[model samples]
Target: MISAPPPRPRDTTFGRSTPDAMQLSPDIPTVELTSLLGGGREAVILHNGERYRLRVTANDKLILTK
Candidate 1:
């Protein structure tokens, strides 16, 4: 009988953090939180070496800009 090929491994990085997240680790994305708290506003996060800015909106979502 024919056999099916082995299944591929799934990517577990869906909710995982990226390099920027690592650098901005520990901190709760100051700007993001600020904007979120400010209500319907946008905030920009800053860090070093990692080269990126974290943007958070009133929606309470974190987006890393490289």
Candidate 2:
């Protein structure tokens, strides 16, 4: 039998990510945004118990709270 790698954490920080998604590297920290138009790409919101910010870019990018 073979054992799989450890499971990754959820997107509690911000910007919801589905299962089997690429997780953010520990070295690179995402920068969260505040507001946006229509709330599509380039939009951010508070998360993680209101301790972080999540941003989405036009290119489907994500960042943590600044």
Model 1 CA lDDT for position 60: 48
lDDT of each: 0.57, 0.56
Number of the predicted model whose lDDT against the real structure is largest: 1
Q: lDDT by residue for model 1 over 1-66, one digit each (tens)?
A: 999999999866555556453445575754435544365344444566556656664664667777
Q: How close is candidate 2 to the true structure, as a TM-score?
A: 0.25
* RMSD for each of the candidates: 7.9, 12.2
Q: Looking at candidate 2, what is the lDDT of residue 24?
A: 61
TM-score for each model: 0.28, 0.25
Q: What does candidate 1 score on TM?
A: 0.28
Where's the lowest-lDDT run of ten residues in candidate 1? 36-45
Per-residue lDDT of candidate 2, residues 29-62 (tens digit): 5543333435454434456556554556567676
